[model samples]
Structure formats: C-alpha cells, structure tokens
Target: MKKHLSIFKLKPLSMLCFTFLILISSCKKEESDPNEQLQDGNSTVITDLAGDTQAAMGSATPGKEARPFYIFLFRLKDQKQIWIRNATDSAQWLKGKDWDLAFTGPYNSEVYVNDKKYRYNPGFEGNAESAVVMLEQQYDLVDQAPSDQVFDASTITKIGWASSASANGWFFYSLSTHIMQAIPNRTYAIRLPDGKYAKLQLINAYKGNPPSVTDLNWPAPYFTFKYYVQQNGSKNLKTK
Candidate 1:
C-alpha cells in the first residue's frame, strides 16, 4: 500500500482523452445545408440498368414510345407509326424475305389515337435499313450516320417519331458497332452522385466476352446494340 501512488490510475490521461475526441470529430465541419438538398428530392443513380424512364423529359405516356425521330416534316409534334405498306397496297415495302416491309400489324392501335405503332416485332424492323438510318438522322441525332440522309431505296413509310425532344431526338441502332459502340457497353465506371464518374464504352466492342468471329455470336443473329443518355436536360438513358 505504501507503493500505491497512482492518481486514479490515469492511463496517460485516458489516452489523451481518446485522442482529443477523435480530433474533435475529425475537424467538426458540417454546414452544407443548402436547404437540406433543396427539400431532399433525390433520385438519379441508374446510369442504365437498361435505363428506361419511359423516355423521360416531361414523360407523356399518352401511349408511350415517342422520342425524337423524324424525316421530311420538321417543326415539332410528330410521332407517327402507321403500317400497311402492302399486302396488296401495290406490293410496296410490306414484302420481305429477311427484313423490311409493313412489319407491324396494320392498324387499330386503340383506334389510332394519335398513331403509335412501332411494329416490326420479334426483334424489330419496320423497314429496318437500320430503321431508315434511325429515322433519317433526326437532327443529326447527336452523332449519326449511315450515309447521313437520303435513304429512299424505294420506300413507303409508316412513320417513326420526331418533331420534338429537342429537334428530332431519338436514334438507336446496332448492326454491330459504331454509334459509340452503344452506351457504356461493358461499363467500368458510372458512379455519379457528386463523387464523379461516367466513362462508358462499346465504341468498337471486340475487347472480350465476345466469341464467334463475325456471325455476331448465334444463328446468324445481328442486333448489335444501342444506347442513350440525356441527364440534366431531362434524364434520358436508352440503355442498350
């Protein structure tokens, strides 16, 4: 007991008060309450889970599938999609062996209320010459080409969107490559949320997971890929 000289056994003063309260909670700096995130209305982290906000930007959905795509008539408000090129309508484009020709039904899409019939089912192809080069390069669709316009290889037309979403804003096609390889194809980074990241790929594909030399992989198949991204200007991501 004569050796007891401890002042409440202070183990170096409780390790310097637990390292000074963890450096004062790591420099106590918290005051970014910008109206608490403008009233906390958040939701934007899907950089393409097949990203389909039903074609954002005001999102009408009066029947769906209306996203910038046109040719000829340009001024705004156009999303046609009629059919019936010819089962006898003079054998126009409705005749096929591998692709093309009145591919979708004929009519009655709810009594054609503002028309919208992107037929060509099964894999899609309503006169698919790359779908008329993505509907005649709707306002240069950001980056489009297939001979940049003038695709009248004997046509008939049923229509395919346009007149809005920022001057004909829709173009997606992939017979295997080009069009920036089809949006974040393999996706190595896409994080976004302030931390920052967006990198995407597919511009030429051929890097890996790809076999079968050129038939594009199975049974003479050729659908390639497609993509779309329009954040801020109204979050649109046509994830391929």
Candidate 2:
C-alpha cells in the first residue's frame, strides 16, 4: 500500500515537471515572436516618399550649369523629412546628427549615412556614430543585427545603383534598357547615431511603388522604403 502511494506521488511530480517545461517553452516562443514585437509598436513603414521627383533629368542647355535642387534628409527616429538646398547653405542639416539618411545625387538615387567619414557626407565632422551595412537576405528574414565589428568592417558608403560589374548596391541599372531597378531581397541594416539598430528595405524608386515599370516616362525618384527600429536599445530587430 505504501509503495502504491509512492508511485502515485512520483507520477504527479513528473507530470508537473513536464507541464513546467512546456510553459517555459511557450514563454520563450512568445518573447521571440516577430509578430508580437511588431504589435508592440517598434516598426515603421514609410511608403511613396518623394525624393525630388520634379527635378529635371539633366542640364537644359549647352555650357550651362544645371539648377541645383534640395536634398531630402530623413530622420528615422521621428519619421521627419527635412529638405536642404545642397547648392546653398546645407550646414544645418549636414553638420548635425538630426538626420539619419541623406538622399543625394541626381534624382536622389544615392544614399549616405550621417557618419563623418567623407567630406560631402551628412554629419561630416560631427559626433555621430551611425553606420550602414547591406545584406543580401530579405528584409523580413533578417532578425538580428550583425556585430558592431561587422558594421565597422563594412565599406558601403553609398547605397545606390550598381554602376559597374563589381559594385555592390541596392539597385541595378540596365544600360540597354536605361532603367533603375531595385534588387529583390536586398536590405540595409543601419546603426543609428543614438546607438540603436534599424533595418531598412528600399522597396521601389518609382512614383507609385510599382512592382515593375515598363514605361520610361514613369515618374521616378519617389522612394518607398520600410524600416524597423529596435526601440529597446537591443539588437532584436525581428520585424515580420
């Protein structure tokens, strides 16, 4: 009779242990769930952001300098777009850490982080610690940011068109077709100046963010990009 009682008590304890393990597994899964993280308001998606869409293609006349247009500087933290005339006074935007990304060059095709690595880059000579890293994986699949050492080793200054055979960038330019196409599954992992991490996906460059544009006259320089800034100051950038 005592042996039977002992066996019954041992079985209940074993079942309790198994139940505790299952609860632990469920808690871990919930903590790491991408959807739950997104629902907590840690992601942002900016679509159809116009980046100098009205600017002319090239110089209008021979021996005449083309009119310079303002560059769009974006602040990822607040989702604000600040316009700065590059030909004129750009010190307020370029010299400060108020901007995270700079949309420069013709049609705003080139992008630069606010790191003081180059003379013409944003936050030049400032105290910003921002960096950019390009990844070949799709945006949704990139759950973790690479180590800070990896960001330090990256050499991608501009995240624009791949002009040459050996160039690495976000878009592909077809010489025959004269079209700029954003490469699929290309995402940029950015280290914000404030020491937080974010993942950016440059979706399209056309006005409507179309999947494919056959017409050459389709209005362009309009950017459609989405990003998720890990707000908890950790590298958990899992945004589904």
Candidate 3:
C-alpha cells in the first residue's frame, strides 16, 4: 500500500480552485443589469386622479378632502413623473412650475387643463371669468388624425358645448355621444410647455376591479389614462 500513491486524491490547490470557481459563479448570479428593471418605451399609465366630490366642489381644502384633484407633472427627456393633490389654498396653483404638463378634473365629468398655467379658465366661455383656452374635442378630426398622433395646444382654443353642459358633460354616462364617455379608445392630445406633444386615452375611470357605475365610488373620483410623451422636440404629432 505504501508503494502506491493515488493521483485522484483531492489536493489543497484543487480545493482552492474549486471554491474560487464557486465564488465567481455566485457573483455572476448576483449581478444584474440596471436597465432590466426600468420601464421601457416613452409611455406611462396614470391609474387615478385624486379628488372627490367635496374636493371638486371646493368645499374642502386641497389635501384635506377625502379626494382632491391631482397636480400632474410630466417631463419628456427621462420620463420623470409626479402626481400630487392640487393646492387651491396657496398662490402656487395646482400646476407646478417645473411641470411640463398638468391636468385636473372629472369635476362633473369635465376635465380641465392648466396648460402650463397659461391663464385659462375652467368655466364656461364668453363668461366674464372664462379661460382664454379650454380643453375641447374635435369630432370630425377624430377619424382624420391617427389614434396615436400628438395634438397642438394652440388648436384647442374654445371650450366645446359637450364638455361643459349639464347631465351631458364630456365624459359622463348621460352624454348622448359615445366618444364623450371616459371609456376606452377615446384619445386626447396636448402640447407640452416646451412645444412638445403628448397624447392620453382613457382606460378606466370607475373604481373596483372590473369598473362599473354602481361601483363608481363618487367620493374617491378615480381616473385612469394611458399617456405618451413625445421624445423629440418637435410639434409633429406623428413623431415619437
């Protein structure tokens, strides 16, 4: 037995090499690409707008109500986003200065736009306090324009009657027109502060899993919309 030496014996150097290989393998498994977790594309989904009936009616302060209109912040380059309750009590306004775009609404089914706080009134046009520009719809152009096309804000000057009427507001169930509902496939476009373009289409405005009027959850005024922000610095709707 003393005359034979087995070459198959596990040497200390072999053990060390084996352990080093395992360490390298473990490190590789732990490593991950940073971009893997990031959201791809230039689109975002905003599932809800914070304000309830009491908040919309101006009965309660911005953040004190059960629900409050949200101050949406949209940036194009990196796609940074922020959504907060509109602060009506302060002079700061619901529209943030750093924000490229802002939206407020579902107030009686009417959505309002701050348009970068460009001095637009949310009330009826021709009224002494009416805004210079309001969010309106163009039924004829709906078919003409591509569904994903971006829209110019300069083109949206007047508040359409369908968007401001009683019982038949822009997106309520009582509206006679099907396009007026905040239902799926209804798309809207807007121009950003830097003259860029963006588009939004409703997904779900009701509460609960399936979404229904009976599950409306009035006090919670939830809103959901899919939005796309144009990366190029052009006003062209077709450009991404």
Candidate 4:
C-alpha cells in the first residue's frame, strides 16, 4: 500500500514535526532569481531535450517563449483529454491547476490502466501519500524532442524557471512505473515575480518506470499531485 497524506489540519506540534521533516529532506540549495530584460531576443528551435542534450524552448506553437506550465492538460467528465489552450505544449496547459497528475502518455493505455486498476494486487506501492520528499531536492521536466530523437533514461538532468510560487521539489506519481527504471525528466518555464522567465528540473535523474506494483488499490481517496490556477482571473503564482 502507498502512504497517504491526510489533508486534515495538523495540530501545532504535528505541523512542526512535518515542517522539520521537510527541511531535512530537501536536497537542492536555493538559487538567486535570474530575471533581467529579455530584450526580446531571437527564439531558438530545439530538436529534442533528452536526445540532443542542449536544446531549449523555442518558437513552438502556443508555448510562446518556451513556457509550458501555461501549457495545459485536462479530461472531460467522461475522462477524455481536453484542450485547455491553443499551444503545442498541451501536456502542461492545464497542469498543476484543474487536474490531478495523470499519466504523461496518451490514454491509449486504458487496457493496461484498467487491468492494473482492477488487479487488486494489494502489494502495490507509490503515491503522493507515500512519495519521498527530500527536504530540498530540486527537479524539472524534459522538453519535447524532435521526431527523430528520443529521451534516454540513464543520465541526471536539470532545468530552471521563474516560478509562480516558492514551492519546488521533485513530484512523483506513485502509479507511474518502476522507480529505478522510471524516467525523471520534466522541464518547466516559469514566470518570475519580475515577469521574466526561467527554467528548473531535478539535480540527479533517471529514465525508468515507477516502483514495483505488486498489490495496489485504495480506500477513501487516491494519492496524487495537487494543482494550481489563478484565483484573480490573471495567472496567480501564489501558493494555495
């Protein structure tokens, strides 16, 4: 079974303990803000993030200026992926906002999903509740590569961004695959407090599936990632 973080309000002492644990777990030392006049420089085109090793956000579809957090993703009540914006980076369009973290690949794996869901192995592991939150470990996402190259799963990767909030840590969906075999590649382009953009990702990384899935099921609630959206009509980076 996976660990589940109760959303219940913590008492003073419990809250303090949790905070202490978080501090000890984080692995990344904070960095100074990287905001400067962009000068509207020329945007470059990257073939792939994983394969090329040196590509970045360019003039792709709607990810204008390489910002994909504005990139969106969603599902209808019927569970079909919905279009949240008019951008090529649709994957993150609706991200950290209206939806719980879902599988990154397309939903064509419904058969595998259903099979895995109903398997009732009872020994399955991994979930937000059970996620390992090192006090200060840093992380980011991989970019969209060209059709020719693909993201490999063996090296540590990194990226950065001007974020909407102070919260930044490695996020894992316990249901992904095997942890060691799982791919830890995800990139982000965040708008800083000064309206300038930046990028971020994990320090050391991997390319593999989620952890082992022996017996898995849930009770009351399923563990997953939280989302963020603007409460003031305009994009609000404030943490909820």
Candidate 4's residue-wise lDDT over 20-135, tens digit each?
A: 77666552222211111111122221111121112123333331233332212222122244333344443333222332222222111100010111222111221211011111
Cα miss at 8, model 2 (Å)? 46
Tell me how far the alpha carbon of residue 235 in candidate 2 is from the true structure, in angstroms, after superposition.
0.8
lDDT of 1: 0.25
Q: Please write out the lDDT profile of model 1 over residues 25-115, one tens digit for every residue.
A: 6555233222222121222221111112223223355444444211011000121223332344323322222221121211110010011
Report the lDDT of model 4 for residue 226: 19
For 206-225, candidate 2 gives per-residue lDDT tens digits of 87676677887777778877
The alpha-carbon deviation from the true structure for residue 58 of candidate 2, after best TM-score superposition, in angstroms, is: 2.1
Better of 2 and 3 by lDDT: 2
TM-score of each: 0.17, 0.76, 0.46, 0.19
- Select the stronger candidate by TM-score from 1 and 4: 4
What tens digits encode model 3's per-residue C-alpha lDDT throughout 26-50? Answer: 7754563222212234456555544
Clash-forming residue pairs, model 2: none
Better of 1 and 3 by lDDT: 3
Candidate 2 off by > 4 Å: 1-42, 59-69, 86-89, 164-166
Candidate 3 pairs with clashing backbones: 50-68, 51-67, 51-68, 52-67, 121-131
Cα shift from native, residue 33, model 2 (Å): 26
Q: Which of the predicted structures, 1 or 4, would earn the higher lDDT when compared with the native?
A: 1
